[model samples]
Target: MVSDKNSEYKFTGGNSLTGIHKLYHEVMMLNELWNGYGAYEVSYAAGKSGISFGGNQMDMHDNKKTAEKFTNILISATDNAGKHFFTQGEVKMIVGNEFVNLIQNGEVVLSMLGDNLASINAALSSVYGRARIDQLYVSEIKNGAEHIEKVIEKITNAAAKKFYDSDLGRVLLFDYHNQYDLKFDGRFLADYINGKGKENFSTKEMVVAPRDHSKYRAIC
Candidate 1:
């Protein structure tokens, strides 16, 4: 009977030890699983954030490119026509008695007068012959200036609307806080879209304001 009690105690203690070992092994397995899942979650979140940010940048870049292209097209068309009309009648005159005399013995005179105000008036009359020069000049000053102003206004309005309607604009106006160190309130984008934005900011005031005119004059 004593031997039986001792055997029972040994068996019970051994079973308890086995149970503790099994519990520890289960806990270790669960911890490994949780850590693996956590690593995967972290990687996925990082990838998703990167993709979102990159997409926004690319979209903004494309919007700016399109705006620039449209601006260039309008500017090129108007500038080219203005330049041609202004320089079309340029001419030069040469005076000499004979070819050999002009070359060695005689003097020659060269004159260029097509770019004078009188020549320009004549050319303008020829192109717009139905109207008087004075009348045309007045029309150009009033009606022509108004037309060009309207064109510029249209281009600027369209560009501002397009930029503000874009996803990047929403993010910049709402999500990002520091845009080039300017404290942009949420309404800046809206105001610019509505043609009420401020126009007093200078792009080169710091670098050009106090410099010598001869040293910092624009080349073009």
Candidate 2:
């Protein structure tokens, strides 16, 4: 385990999710390691000084008599490494536009909901041996009621945008259709939702990859 001297560091940037995501993702990695499924390499640095290590399921087998020691090592190493990444001016986390607006259609949303849920249910049945998807879906909706309301507001705004932007989008669509003189398919309505057709109806944010784990070790 990393010593308290190494673990004691400062965080300057405020990311609503950065700390939580690191904690949760690291715990998930530990759980996978416990199940003999994953490995992690952790590195620590303070100014010009640094150290690194790694462990895997084989190490856990070697330390089964004192498994908590191994667990602490993994957790502490991850925590300290994350602290370095955040405090050394390496990663910048910016929170922007809590709510995004995009054109949406009720019918399209409903269709997407049905298609996505059906696919989810099928996969859940194969993996978990039953259909708990709808039950969990309802629970999420209840728990996230506030977020749901915000989503509704965004969707409403998007629907209004579709009406206002119809001319440009429609001209583009009409030109495409007229150029090909293609027969209408059911996809036309879905395409009409995005005007000129993008894969997903909503805009998406880009993600940045963090630095690689610098070192690793194993016991077994």
Candidate 3:
């Protein structure tokens, strides 16, 4: 029940007051005192200049109240502090390329589709040849449709990248057995489509972390 200006009053002596009636009386006095004072202000004078008080404190107070009203809206719209959102197609591309990069980097131990482990292994081996590939066989048959749709979307979007420089970017693979890899060689393919390849050739890297860290570590 404390008035806005007298908000500090509760922290002063209210801790000792036992009875509810006593607390009520104290709150009433605080409200009266706050209303009589209008608002608090301070003034400073420099040299012979006249001192001025209450210049824009009231405006600032009003602005603070206005700001509080919209605080929730502001917080909701900008709360991306720790979350990442990706489109279906983008996610597929990232997953596919990440798998390929892992295989090329020799980090993957297995790869599979549904219960078809041997087929998947053979397909990937035939596509990349003798490379170590990881297998992940999906036990749930219900996810097959969604998985296929995502793969197709990723492949369609990825196919647009195959005619530039080999070092331009990592290619996404849809049909490992069929050798369907989406290559974004450079800005050349994009530029060629937009009629700008004649001006410049794109510089890019097809391999991920191509440098040998082991060699650098030995030198160090």
Candidate 4:
């Protein structure tokens, strides 16, 4: 239930996305800008991830978390054809943890026999070839909304069914999705709104991340 109401807020870089896409895509663009990265470039910065790869700045580190993210995205992107190089049966043992380790150090080069896990090399050249792009980028913003909805509903109540129906509300949820702390009940959004004295949200500026958490910093 998105809002039909309009506001004077303008999107940065000016994308053609509308409705939910508009807010979600705009947030991605802002993420790139914040990290000083282009859509295709890879960086060695360590914020959330040791290696930020691709447009969405995905974590390419050698760990369980990264393995899971790549696995899910690979399967979702193409009927599991791309990820089989690491996820296939029995042979998964070879590429499972070692693959991430090889990635963290430098280039990966391997050739195995009778193993369902495909060959891996520097460029990931394999018998299966390259992955086909279903979209410009892979993202899970919609999925994160599942957790965010619970927080919004519990903390903000009427705001979820009402204020959250607007573009601003959607964008706020997207922003919070990145910085959300699991230990908290997602009251950060509600506290942010209250800190700004917004009984009823009135401006796009209110939707931006606060320069300082101010009074709400302690709550988080």
Q: Per-residue lDDT tens digits of candidate 1, residues 31-116?
A: 22232121101001121121000101111112333223212222222222354323211221111122111122111111122224
- Per-candidate Cα lDDT values, in order, are 0.24, 0.26, 0.24, 0.39
lDDT by residue (tens digit), candidate 4, 1-220? 0112111222122243455765666676666434322332223443333433333444455555544543433333322344443444433453355455324522221222223222322112222212211132333444555555665554433433355545666566666564343223333554443243333255534342234434233333
Q: What is the TM-score of each candidate against the true structure?
A: 0.16, 0.14, 0.14, 0.44
How well does candidate 3 score on lDDT at residue 220?
28
Give the C-alpha miss distance for residue 155 in model 2, angstroms: 7.9
**Reference-based lDDT, residue 187, model 2:** 34
Candidate 2 regions with alpha-carbon error over 4 angstroms = 1-128, 141-146, 152-220
lDDT of the structure predicted as candidate 3: 0.24
Model 4 stretches with alpha carbons more than 4 Å out: 1-18, 33-37, 60-65, 68-139, 157-165, 179-220
Decide which is better by TM-score, 1 or 4: 4
Candidate 1 Cα deviation (angstroms), residue 167: 34
lDDT of 3 by residue, 1-220 (tens): 1123321111221223334323332432343234322112211122221111111111111233312211211222211242223344533343343333112211121221223323222222231211111111111111222332333333222223222111111111212211112233423222332233334325542322213334323422
- Candidate 2 minimal-lDDT segment of 10 residues: 94-103
Error of 3 at 117 (Å): 11
Regions more than 4 Å wrong, model 3: 1-102, 106-188, 198-220
Cα distance off (Å), candidate 2, residue 46: 44
Candidate closest to the true structure, highest lDDT: 4
